[model samples]
Every structure is written in C-alpha cells, then in structure tokens.
Target: MTNASDAAGDEKTKTANEKAMAGSETDTTSPASPTVRTEHEDDLDDAFKYLHDHSNAESTSIDLAALRRKIDWRIVPIMFVCYVLQFVDKVVINYAAVMGINKDLALTKNNFTNVGSAFFIAYLIAEVPTGESTSSHGANKVLTHILQDISSRNFHLESGWALTCLSGESVAQRPQEQPTITLFSPHYYTKSEQAPRFAIWYSGLGFGQIIGGLISFAFQHVTNKHFKSWQAMFVFVGIATSLVGMATFFILPDSPMKAKWLSEPEKAALLKYVSINQTGIQNKNFKMRQALEVLADPQLWLLTICTICISVSSGVITTYSATLIQSFGFTPKRTALLNMPSGLVSIAAALIVGFGVRKSESRWAWLVLCCIPGMIGGGLMSFMPASNRAGLLAGIYLVNAITGTLTVIYQWTMANVSGHTKRSVAAALIAGSFSIGNIIGPQTFQARDAPRYYPANIAVMSTQAGGAVVAIVLFGYYVWANNQKDKRQAVEEGLSSSAGNEKILWENLTDKENPNFRYVY
Candidate 1:
C-alpha cells in the first residue's frame, strides 16, 4: 500500500509538470504568425517566472468565489482606510478655512485660493515621477504608503499660513498614492468584477468628507489657550493618517503573487483567471516604445481630457463647499454640519454608478448619467438666489453626483490600457490632468466674486457637459478600433476576431500591439 501511494503521487507530479511546461510554451513564436516574437523572453511577466519554477506543484481545487472573498477582506479594508485618510488630510484645509485659519494666519485677498492651488501644483509635478517609481521599482504599492506616512508627520510642525502650505505639500503626495490604490482592483478582479470593487475603495473620498466635517465640528468646541481648534484638527488627523499608513505598509500585499497568505497553487490559479484581462501581471521592464506610444494614444488623451473636465467640479467641492455654505449666513459650526449631507450624496452616487456598471456593463452610460445631475446642480447654484438658502444648498448636494464619474474613469483606464509601462504613463497623465482641473477650479473663484462666484459655477456646468460629450466620443473610438482590428486579423491571419490563445494574454504587449486585446468601454 505504501509503494502504490508513492507511485500515484509521482505520476500526479509528472502530469502537473507537463501541464505547466505546455502552458509556458503558448507565448512562444507560433507557426501561424512566424514573423516575430510577441515579447522578449526577458520581458515576460513576473507571473510567468513563478509558473515556470512551480511547474511540479499539484493542482488543487479552488473555489474562485471564496478566494475572491478572502482577497477582498484582507486588502480592500486597507485600501479603504488609506484613501479615507488621504482625502481627509487634504480637505481638512477646507474645513480649517471656516475654523478661522485664514484670519489666524493673516491671509488676505487671494492668499486662500493660492493655498488651494498650491496643493494641485505639487500634485501635478509629482504625478509622473511617482508613477514611474512604482513601475520601475517592481510595482510595489507599499512604497507610496510609506511616503505618505512621512509626509503626514509634517502636519504637526507648522503654524500660520506655513501650516496650510505644508498641508498642501503633504497632501500632494496623494497623487502618488491614488494610482496604486486604483491599480489594485485590476490585478485581482476581471473587467466585470472591478467596478464595484473600485467603488468600494473610492467611496473613501465620501467617508472622508463626512468624517472631516464631524472632526471640524467637534474641534470647534475646543477651548485651549495655546492651540486653536483648526490646529488641533490638523494634529488629530495627521496622527490618525500616519497610523493608517503604517498599517497599510504591514498589511497590504504589493500584488497577488506577493500575497503571503495564498498558497503557490492558489496564486497560480488566481493569475490564470485574471489572465483574461489581456493585461499581464506585473512587468518591471520599462519599454521606451510603450512610453512613446502614450504621447500618440488617442484613448489616453481622451481619457485625460475627460478626467480634467469632471475634476473641475471635484476641486470646487473639495476646497470651497464649506466657504459657500458659510456665505449663506450660517455659523461656522452649522456650515460644517451642512457639509456632511454632501458626503451622503457622494456615497450614494458612487454606490449607484458602481453597481450600475456591474449590472449593465455600460460604463459610458453610467458616467453620462452621473454628469447630468451635476450639470443640473451647477445650474441651480449659478441661478438660485442666495436668499433661497435651501435651494442653493440642494444644488451643492446634487453637484456631488459628478464624483461618481471619477470612479468610472479610474476603472475604465485600468481595464482598457495594457502593458505595464503604458498603463503607468496613462495613470500619471490622467492624475496630472485631474490636478490641472483642480488648479483651474480654484483659480476661477476670485475674491472679486465674493458671495456668488458666477464664473466658477458656470465653469462647473460647462465642464460637466463637455465631459459627457467626450465620454461618448471615447466609446465610439473603442468600437471603431475593435472593428479595425477584426478586419486586419481576418485578412492577415485568416483568424476570427475572437481567435486568441492563452499565449497572447501573457505577453507584455500594449493594447495596440496585442491583437487579442479588446477595449472595455
């Protein structure tokens, strides 16, 4: 009986090795298309290397649903906390404006608006380098979290406008942190499963809004002589943010392959399932070709423009909503409370569109649907009389619906782009465009237009409409590109549009280079 059992185990090991070897050969030069190799052997994905070495491992039965749940529980909460703290740290300045930071710091004229703009300026400059750093350094997401922790520590040091300027610099590191957060879902989930997961984490922005408001409101009651309420709020949020950052460093896995809790077989199985994305698991090679392709990729440009347009409204909401409410004859404490409802609006919109995309698979449609309410809200804010405080306040809440479009945009970029270098560059471009819009958003609100910034409100309305139009154009472009690829494949290879093999999926090819890749709208 012992001899028989050993023989059976040996046979199983032999069969597993054979299967792994066969899988590894799929990406090699094929007889049908013999002109060139899809990728150099050195450029193969990290998952490819893992599978090659683990060839003799026995195949274990895995419940994909259970595995997914396990991954979600372990990683999603960490991501959620990181996002919440980042936003709260950044927007705490908005709350502080009402808490008398401007008066206490002796900021006059456009000094307040400049402070808001300064954050995005730093954010824009840091975007590309951060993306490059993540890609070149083995795509480790934890590095950014550590950087965030270091930046958060500075929040406790400065006083006066110096405190606010340091806040801008600290939060500017967020652009570095965000792409990694958004990039995490695509690694584990398929196109269909990604929307809701993205929403789950991105909703941290809304939670930050609510929690920031409560923090500001609570701190306003502080009666200390040496430290003001705003100063205390900074210290409290800074300490909390640093703690969460430390937790992220220890808890979050850089990628599925790096996840310590998953067994070797489980990791292989997960990688195989997500291979359908036609976007390989992490590749560290920085291809100059892929980097150059970004400059000319129409999809990248369109996505960047759309992000910029929608983010204009986000800037308005993040920096000035409290100031707007206070301008409506409310006290500082009441203004903070009033801002809390907008958080609910943001959360509701994110959940609605997230589940909507998952159910209907119409990302573009959901994006346009979100923009409509935002445009309506912009109109209301622009036209409603200030005496009608309730009406204008309703407008402010409705504007938050546009925030959902950002969640869609984030998922869309990850799902549609392929190749590690191209994806990284694209993420940076989209993020930088966001900073550009934010810069523009605050500049539109000159002190000259005190109570009612008509120009800024109109800019919000116009940009929302523009974003919807561009989203439609982007959808049309994807459809046309897919058709063109199909025609070329039929003529050159005598293959149908769906004629893709596992080999093509593992190759580190860009969406343009990979004939198998189909863009997800």
Candidate 2:
C-alpha cells in the first residue's frame, strides 16, 4: 500500500513539473534535431530501453556498487594522477627552495616568491581560453595542450628557450592534459554519489605531495654527476606526468553513451541514469547568454569567493611549507621529511569529508566544519611565539586539513548548477578565481615578512573564518529563495504545497532561471 501511494505521489509531482516547465520557456522543450529514424537509433533503444526514458530508472537489477567500482577503475585514476602531476609540477619548486634553487638560479630577495606568483598569474591568464575553448572543442584536443602549461614551470622561463629545456628534457615538454571536471562528473555519477568519489579522486593531491616529497628526498641522495638534484627531480616527475597524460588522452571516456569499454546495454543504462543531470551528452553550441549569466550569478560569485579563500590557504602552504620549516632552523634534509606528513593530514581530512558528504544531508554545514580547523591552525600560528616549534608545527599540520575543502566546493558547484554552457563557464570562473587567490597568497609572504611568515599564516586563518560566515549567508539565501518560490507557485498556479515541491530534472535550467531548481545547502 505504501509503495503504491509513493508511486502515485511521484507521478503527480512529475506531472506538476511537466505543467510548470511547459508554461515556462525551459530547455526540455528546446528543439532537438529531427531524428532521421535510422537503424542506429533503433539499436540503441532496443539494447537498453531507457535511451528516451530520461526520468525513469529502468535497470535496478544491475548492482550499483559493482558498476560504480568498474567506473572508478576506468575514470578516476587519470583525473587523480594528472591533478597530482599538476600539484607536483608546482610543488617541486617548493622542494627546490631548500635544495639550493636560490643559489643555483641566482635568486635574490623576493625572486623565489616572484617566481611562485608568476605561475599562478600565467594560470589565471590561461584559464579563460582553457575553459572557453575546451568547452567548444572536445576536452581531448585542447585540454591536453592548455594543461601542459599548468604542469610546466615555463612561466619562470623569462630567460628564453635555454632556460626552458635546461633539464636536457624540458619539464615543459610534458603533455598538458587538463581533465575536464565538469564534463566527467555529470557523465559518471549522480549528484548524490559524486562527492565521495570526487573526494577519493581529489585525495590525489595528498598523494602527489607525498610523491613529490619522496622524489625530492631521493634526488638529494643522487650521486649522478650529469644532473643536479633539483633538476633531476623536475625531469623525473615531468616525464612520469607526461606518460599519465597520454594514457588519459587515449583511455578516458568522453561520454557515457560512447564509452568503448561498456557493452551497449551498459552504455544505454549509464546514459539513462545520468540524464536527470539535464546536462546534455555534449553541446558544441556555446551560448553568450549563459556566459553572461556566469558574470551575473551572485551565487557563483559566492562560490568563487569561497574557493578563493580556500585556495589562498593552499597557495601559502604549497609555496612556503618547506620554506617555513627551514626558517625554524631545521636542516634542509630534515625539512623535506617533516613536510611529508602534511600530505597525510590532507588525505585523512579529504576522505573524511568526502564520505561525510555522501552520508549527510547538508553540504554548507560541511564547508563550515572544514573551515573551523583552518581557523584554529591560523590562530595558533598567529599568536604563538616562533620558539614554540612543536606547537607551530602542530598548527601547520592542522591547517592542511582545509586542503580538502577545495574538493568540497568543486563538488557543490557540480551538484547544484546545471545548463551546459553555464556550468562550463562557472567551472572556468571558479578555477580562475582560485588562481587569482593563489596569485595573491604567495605575495603575502613578502621578503620583509620573512622567517616566521606571520602575515601569510594570519591571512590563511582569517580568510577561512570569513569564508564560514559567507557560507552561512549563502545557506540562508538558498532557504529564503526556496520559500519565496514556493509561495509564488501557490499564488500563481494554485499549486498545493506537495505540488509546489516538484522539481524539474533533465531540463538543464540554471538555479536562477528555474523555479524548480533548488540550491544545495
């Protein structure tokens, strides 16, 4: 009896949604190309009966856990490794700081810091084209090139081609494969299941940090006369990063409907399952209105602001963790070993929150939960005396826990936002804002504020606290907006409260444009 009533209620809600969408100019009613009624279309629908059944679940017999595991093996590794390479590419320089990069490169006061900042500035400039072009062209063709610059240290090659390939093999020569986060998430998992998987994949950041530390440490023992220790570190990590990028370029599936590994039924079922995401399989048509909507979106700006705050903390740590340890008067060798544990802290926090989001109902609360530790770590660093080395080191470890928050914000944006162009633009803007903060973060470690780097530590803590307040404000805004929508629906359409609760999936509506689109709190 209960199942029957539930089914009836769901049907009623779905009917109400269809009525509401028809009255409004929404994407579901947008014209699709008239089907040529070919045998190919017939084969697709026949093999799996859900190609056109966008809202219904047709195959519950397939074990979700087993299938998700399969998807994990195929999809997650390249995303993780490429991201790891991206971090290691940036992080090797931090290791270089302790390894005599300053003396070798003839780096003077603030020269090292400037080199660090230069990469992000280049990253900031590159993101606009990376986002726009990758969305228009396929992720395979353009992303491989743009992401190479991300992993390359070429931004500091102000000295021309000589400095570019100084390693006998240029780190810049590595394949630039920027995995499209927006494209992949919608294709593989439902919004509810995405956070944990993204968290696990994002755990790659911690792994990369650990790998980078080991690489740097091992190179320190290098007896080879041909290459300097830091130079060897770059060459090794760069080559390994390139191999992974090439593998990803060839292996990663572009869409659920087109994945080579999946049988036709499996492909159709996967496509049917993710269809409620409302993001079309792939759209080449870039809309200016959606691009403009990105600029106009207040929530997107809030998301961007939150990411900037978190990324600032990341930037400070990435560029300066080794430097800070060295400033404590530890030898360069020991400093490398001490830095390895921060990655472990980050991994623990990332997995905790990733799985936490999977189990919990609220995402905003989780964001604030992650921020509290960052705030505490910042306070410890700000107020504690420099002599309290153990206390300060503990605080540094605590601060790394916030590194996982970047993963959270990325997942939130993916789960909540829809419309292909709008999501693409939003992803680009968030990435850009993240780079902008990183660009700002290292500059906080001015040469004048050397040794303790108190100013940078203070920035990490304060920005985290401010971000928490902004998250609550955004949460309130979502709740208030949801209420306003409900009242309007009642007044305008005489919709009952239950009917007003209906939401339109698979229509690709932006949160602002669709009354049925509810914000994730």
TM-scores of all candidate predictions against the true structure: 0.91, 0.83
Q: Model-by-model lDDT, in order?
A: 0.79, 0.66
> What would the per-residue lDDT of candidate 2 be over residues 1-521, giving only the tens digit for each residue?
11222122234324543453332222112223122123433322221222443323334355544566678788877677767777787788789889877776677788777777766775666566555566666665554553454435423332323342332133222222332654576677766567777787778788878888888888888656545677777777666666666676677755665577876546645554554444445655566787788887777888888888887888888888899888877988888888888889889888788777766637788889989989988888777888998878877788888766777788888776766678777777777777778778888898888787889989989888877887888788778877887787768764443322212333345666655555656
lDDT of 2: 0.66
Top-scoring candidate (lDDT): 1
State candidate 2's TM-score: 0.83
> Which tens-of-lDDT digit does each residue in 398-442 have in candidate 1?
999987999999999999999988888888888889899998888
Model 1 lDDT, full chain set: 0.79
Residue 503 of model 2, lDDT score: 24
